[model samples]
Target: MNELFDSVADGLVDKSYAIIDNFLTTDEVAQILTLPHFNQHEQLFKKAGIGKNADLQINEAIRGDYILWLDKNTAPPAAMVYLNRLNELIQHLNRSLFLSMKDYEVHMTVYPVGTYYKRHLDQFKKDDHRKLSVICYLNTNWKEEEGGQLRIYTDHDSFDVLPVAGRLVCFRSDVLEHEVLPATRQRLSLTGWILDQQIM
Candidate 1:
């Protein structure tokens, strides 16, 4: 985990993003995916929407996916374990880079076959607290031909990141505009943001 922290901090400083594969092992990914909470509370998931507060609305044309926000206070055991691990990372990053990240918000995102999200930035105009975006994919047996790639746009060029199981993609929330390409197979991932404490 320390090694990952160093790598993440260095990557963020150098390029504002990092893509790491095998952050979680195959067996660990399978274990999380097989958790009963996903099956038992499937109905809790809802169609993903765009914007926030009054501006928030389901816009299928922009993003066709479903989401279940994970509650930090009431997450299931397996999920809690993962969150704790991430919290450690939050602390590590703060110590190393003083990012001012205080908490995190996460959700389970599912893109059904043929679904996709258009290019967009993660940070909204109303909120600057979202400092970093993190996506840990859990799609096993994914193939390039299946086409559910995460296309990240940079200043000079763009890159397509395959949604392979245990792959972790971290990036600046405000700087990069990205999109999810339509997939022939269903795609699953844990997506979230690292946030700074808002002054009240």
Candidate 2:
């Protein structure tokens, strides 16, 4: 809808960057097909042969709903609008707030019912490429008690970003430790890192 963002979005895509906010509306996200399959990816991790029912959460996730790899090229026009919005946000943070550009990558993550991700770091201490973390929640009709809050940890405090539709959360990917609490309702989000331009 705006000309200013076209260049900005292109810049961020070229350089690993950071910024966050409602990038995808609920209806916009539903365009991506989701199929149901049980522990289909277990064989991918068969080397471990995790015990039966021994909690196959992460191991089985690569199979849709549990975890879906978005075909960004197929995203709707709404996604383009959202990217422009993010470009604006990043400019605000950089010029007004003074956030440094670092190595990062952009991505989308979706979680369905009874799904949860354990606490993890955006980038490994040794591998510092993922410097900025951004998340945009796209699940409509979400409730606090539904329990899919993004637990973010800072030096002295921890905060939860409830998975509200159109809500976005951005933070230091390297310094922030976060997790997704299990949800009673289906929860969805787009999460990714922004890398540094100079690094490329």
Which candidate wins on TM-score? Answer: 1
List candidate 1 stretches off by more than 4 Å: 37-42, 198-200
lDDT of each: 0.87, 0.55
Q: Write the per-residue lDDT of candidate 1 for residues 1-200, one digit (tens) a residue.
A: 78887888888889999887777779878888887645543476888999997999998999998888888789877677667877887898899997789889989888888999999999989988999999989899999999999999999999999999988888999999999999998889889999897323
Q: Largest lDDT belongs to which candidate?
A: 1
Error of 2 at 156 (Å): 3.3
> How well is each residue in 171-194 modelled by candidate 2, as lDDT tens digits?
666676777788887666656555
- Error (Å) of candidate 1 at residue 167 is 1.1
TM-score of each: 0.94, 0.62
Model 2: lDDT to the true structure: 0.55
Local lDDT at 120 for model 2: 67
Model 2 regions more than 4 Å off: 1-74, 98-104, 198-200
